[model samples]
Target: MDWSEIIARSEKSFWGLLGLRMLSADSKLVELGLTVNESHLNSMGIVHGGVLSSMMDQAMGTLVTAIKNGSQGVTTHLNVNFLSAMRSGELIASAYPLHETHRTMTLRSEVRGEDGTLACISTATFRLPRDSK
Candidate 1:
């Protein structure tokens, strides 16, 4: 699918207000790009943890979706490590599948600033739904 279609679909399906454009996606790898707007800022004018968590989730979920056939999954657990502050600007996140089984998938992601500084690292576990069809 095209970038516009991906963005639209993600926004509708995930309620992700931020326009996280997919830069690339393939088996085992996915890259997402986003810009922090005012809505994403916290009271301190820095990006909130929730926003970073959402971005991490999206990156990890998109990686899982690329590998799965017809099944979908929901995040069962997420662990995040914040390294540095993220101010309002552009950022990129890359996610890859670290491990996968019949029922579960684990993904590792790193959020980086425009200057290539590491902002955060995250891991997420998703429980794959049983295919009914």
Candidate 2:
């Protein structure tokens, strides 16, 4: 889907409130972009870890949904590692599947700053509904 379509699809959701934009998406990878704003900052003036974590989660979930042809799943586990601090500018989060079975899919994702510094990395597993299997 195009960016506008993606935005329209999610505009009323939390991702839209965070200003996440779909940079690109395919069966293998999905990239999401976000411009760091005041609302995303923590008390220390750095981007909050939760913001990055949410981006990674969204990226992984989006990819899994696409791979399953719109079958949605629940995140069973999510592990995030904060690698660097970011104060401003933009961030891009990308995700792809690492493994999958009839009812579970695991994905790896990373978020990088505009300068290409890796800010966060994560892996998540989603459990598809029994009917989606």
Candidate 3:
């Protein structure tokens, strides 16, 4: 499926509530954005790690979906590195392909906050469904 359809379906998901926007989606790249708000903050008054992780994971998985020509998949593994703290601003995540096969795809992603400061970096592997239909 295209990003538009995926995002449209996401409209009622937990991630969708974060107000993520699909900036780009194609074979080579996938980028998404979310504006930080009170609902996204952690106890320390910064964007929560889970939120960052979720966005990064989604970015990578969506990229894999695009690269797989619309095949559905789920993240099997995700590793994240928190580089900086974000108080409030737009947070963006972008992913690029690292490796792939007929059944699996690996990708690297990064999250940036205001002024393009790096907030998190992540690597993920997505397992495509065995049944395409």
Candidate 4:
């Protein structure tokens, strides 16, 4: 399947609002890229936790949809850990499923800076589509 189509469908939503791009994707994994700018910064001039969380959620959710053959699901829980501060530069988030059941999929993700620093780590659980297992 053309995973790019999944990202294309998100273009008009918050994904587009944040200028996130699809770096790569497959049936089991998804990677997203974002260039951190002032708009993504917090009061301390560092990347905000929300931005990191959103990026991780997007990647994980996209993976779920890809594996489900384009059926979308909703995020049920998200946990993010900030490891380092990011002031600027590119951020890449990669997510893949860690576990799955009939109703839920849990994914693990990491956001790395351009310099290859582990800026954040995240894990999220998405509720699969009603008709998906």
For every model shown, the clashing-pair count is 0, 0, 0, 0
lDDT per residue as tens, model 2, 16-77: 88899888877799999999999999999999999999999999998987787777789999
Residues 1-133, candidate 4, lDDT per residue (tens digit)?
6666756877889999898999988777799999998999999999999999899999999888878877777999999999999999999999988988999989999999999999999998999877994
Task: Encode model 1's per-residue lDDT on 22-117: one tens digit a residue.
Answer: 888876788888888998889998888887888888888877777774345799999999999999689888998998887899999998989998
Q: In model 3, how large is the Cα lDDT of residue 9?
A: 83
TM-score of each: 0.88, 0.93, 0.92, 0.94
Clashing pairs in 2: none
State each model's CA lDDT, in order: 0.82, 0.91, 0.87, 0.89
Which has the greatest TM-score? Answer: 4
Where does candidate 2 have its weakest 10-residue lDDT segment? 1-10
- The sequence of per-residue lDDT tens digits that candidate 3 reaches over residues 68-119 is 7788688889999999999998889999999878788889999997599999
Off by over 4 Å in 1: 1-6, 13-16
Between candidates 1 and 3, the one scoring higher on lDDT is 3
Better of 3 and 4 by lDDT: 4
Per-residue error for 68 in candidate 3, Å, reads: 1.4
